[model samples]
Target: MHQVHVVGLGVDHRDITPTASRLIDSAEVLAGGDRLLALFNDHPAVKILIKSPLKNVIDRINQEMQSHRKVVVLADGDPLFFGIGKRLIDAFGKDAVIIYPNVTTLQVAASKLKIPWHDIKSISLHGRKDIQPLLTALVGNNRVAVFTEPDFSPAKVADELIRRGADTFNMHVFEDLETETEKTRCFELKDAVKQTFSPLNFIILNRIKQAVISLSLGLDDDLYLHQRGLITKREIRVAGLSSLEIEPHHTLWDLGAGCGSVAIEASLLAYEGIVLAVEKAPERIQLIRQNISRMCAYGVEVIHGEMPECLESLPDPHRVFIGGGMGKDNSVLEAATERLRPGGKLVLHLVLMGSMARARDYLKDLKWPFSITQLQVSRSKDLAGDHRLEALNPVFIISAKKPALRL
Candidate 1:
């Protein structure tokens, strides 16, 4: 039969059966990672598998199947659990393939640790969205399992989770699941910072919820998504929402879309107004996408790269929110304010002393019809089982109009 077979292998070649070994040895071509391919070292003509350049491998597989040659593709743990088998079946179709099962590492991990596998909430965060959604699903006291990648490995996840103030969950990490050198590491959610982990590791988190910082106002500053160390305060966020002036068919620009607060809110406001949230960081770009999706702000479009460069292709603006120029030198706010049609509103926030000065002089030069505001916010806190008050940093705001900017 002209077909492809995807075979799963155990941690070691010794675990493979004679029939599977024979299929590997007699295959016309082999495709997989360096280690997986090396498992069949005796077969000298194995073709290497490269994921990004996927079409090349597909082309070879197609050619082999057309020639009626037997092809065996190798995969790790389970071919169906975050493995390549499903992609093969999807690409080549079910009628053209057969899958030989092997024990997935999770089974081995559970067996080795004597724990139940079905109870753990298994997720692959390799290229999945950040742990925010995963965090939201967390129960007060529960367990979570995650598969890791080189970039978003176990350590990185723990660091991010802790930063987001995940001091409520306990973590259990296991590495090299079924190998001779396998390892498992455990820690409480708050004590996670006490240790780090290896690159190849899986995570299990036990819920460890912290005290509610007055619920509504204290969105757990750690929970809001932002870049390298930048975020919008809830107070400023509420204010920006006020000035968005969103309406049906309105198109808004959230320049320096820190945590996508304005964009998400504008999307909520305009429901029909379009919000373009712009940011320069790759992580924050992804974060904005996740936040928009999480809030189901489908009307909001998350653009990658920097604002002006990223925004060059977007249609004209109806309203713009400048949240980052607080300290930026080559500011996109200038372009946004300039492009704002007659009567269109351009709302801006400046944080740095010098940036505020620069903004004052620049706005004065424009001499547009505008209104300026400064906010000194005080947030309530709890101390000694009583409510206390505290203040966040001060901010300067300006809302200008180009006088017929549009509906």
Candidate 2:
């Protein structure tokens, strides 16, 4: 049987290559969306309008191929990039289909922006309502392009971003790319929400101040609002987080999440993950929410209740951070360890030696693979006219990993 030709009709019908045009013209059967088929109304080929219930179209294409009839399928933009080309190839063997490539909408958007696209990230909200993946991608990326759908349009995206406290990005919207009625405009994320955009549009987000998010582990203690000096020290937070071994998609539990520094940092590291910060103090819960917004750490969810009790409703965690309450009641630790998914890691920070010893004994009793480190952090401070080091309180950090198989 002859191979079916799948042509990418760039942005406009005029953008179709001469070779592709000939393939379309000489085909005995043609299939594409209504709009695409309308573009070639003058063609004498038997046109099949592609629609929902994609299986019907597939069946028709298979029948045409079985009959040895020449068929051409029209696709918008480059078919390989989140397009129908791959689906067709997957259904029919690769050798049975010929793909003619063209400039994708992403490429056109980048070209108009006059920016390098090799380093940029691309996402399609075409049939997706979940923005979690997009939010995760926005964590450290400087440039991103999104293919918008009618339901999840640019304005919806802007609202989501604003809700996530991601005000550091500038939005550029491009509609009807490469056409006479095409429009492109840039706006601050705040203003983007107030504006209307066409459904046939894509969005490019450029970081306004790239330096806001950094790779460093310890953010300044002043960044969070805490009661007295109850927050986790910067050095200890850095030490504990380093040992937690956070992954991009891990669900983390931050017990006694005072000021939520650890959870916030974990949110950044586990951008695609969920971080539940269980803080009983009403004031602290408010502060954690504020800190999350300020840091643009949208992955964090503050639970305004005590740990162990609060953890009941949460999904199993891949990692757990016990920065508080473990010293007061080892039950929190026991609950966390019990609920931690197999092969997950748990890191605990304790300031008191008694609490440290109790935690060590509890971990040892469980016979889980664990280690303890004592951190003595000293910071340089200006005293008189000379710089002198001031020793902060020493803290103990305990880390344990759940075995893949229980004994």
Candidate 3:
């Protein structure tokens, strides 16, 4: 059966395979975004439109398929590297499509760096507002590769990392991969921050022993200056952290930041991720700041404000911990329920049933998937030569996730 053919194109049209080029030039129906279309603008006898809203592209493919004309789908950088190829193939039968390949930006960057990609950590920051964490990852591993964005150029990334906390990694930027206009630079973040260049750039990051995860959150107490009675207890803090389902580079929010232990731990998860410590008390805010500093949680941000409000200003988080600011601030349960990314987790620690009821109700209203846990911890007390058990406090934790919404 004659069906649509999917093609992956490189920046230079000359890179197109002879068969792929012949298919594109002969395709009665051409489909792709402006960049891909303009890439072959001089080719005769075809129509094109800018891809937008994503759904439109899907519809266009469906439309061409009905007409039974040859349709060619074009993409760049492995299309599968955060590209549209997978979705298109998923919608149209894979057997009905043909994909031509080319060198991806990641491949070019690694080749120029003389580093094996398997040994490097990779991240794509296209259209993404953050790339700071990728810089931090360099401190633990060598040979990092990233697809960069315009505003968060290599310079901005270098500056933010060293400015925030990625001093240990060596950095490099590769421009116009695979072309004569290609260029590469290797230097420290401090030096890289001072320089600037073209938008067609990817980064290579390298780091040393700094990759060790700091599990000693206690020693960090001296570092952060937070408010009294506002922080999560180090003992109980593990519960919230565990429920977060955290990974390196996953964003987290400590809505009632308190002393910011959760946010600090979240930051420690990695620099590619964000940890927002939201609190209203100046004392706790100071403590949060100090904790972030002492703990070396460079990616953690301390915001002086209450939950829900402070949480609202940040991007949709991957995980959330409600350690303080419960009461009316339980509104975080509402806001979080709305902004919760698919599979994102929200965990709340409270001794009071009031907060638990609120969380339960909110999750029910949203029809989100959730689980609840109650923990009772006891302390050991000395009585003469005998030891007695004393209960510290019981905590109720509620964790919930919104179903993943996808194209």
- Ranked by lDDT from best down, the candidates are 2, 3, 1
What candidate 3 gets wrong by more than 4 Å, as runs, is 11-13, 33-36, 129-143, 159-164, 208-231, 242-252, 266-275, 281-301, 314-320, 325-407
| Better candidate by lDDT, 1 or 2 | 2
TM-score of each: 0.52, 0.76, 0.71
Query: What tens-digit string does per-residue lDDT give for candidate 2 at 185-304?
Result: 999888888888876788899888653335346888876778878888988888888899998889999988888889888877887777888989888888887776666676677788
User: Best lDDT goes to which candidate?
Assistant: 2
lDDT of every model, 2 decimals: 0.69, 0.83, 0.70
Candidate 2 clashing pairs, residues 3+ apart or interchain:
none
lDDT of 3 by residue, 230-287 (tens): 4566566776777777887677777767777777666656456777777787877766
RMSD (Å) of each candidate, 1 decimal: 11.2, 4.6, 5.6
How many pairs in model 1 have backbone atoms within 3 A of each other, for residues 3 or more apart or on separate chains, i.e. clashes?
A: 15
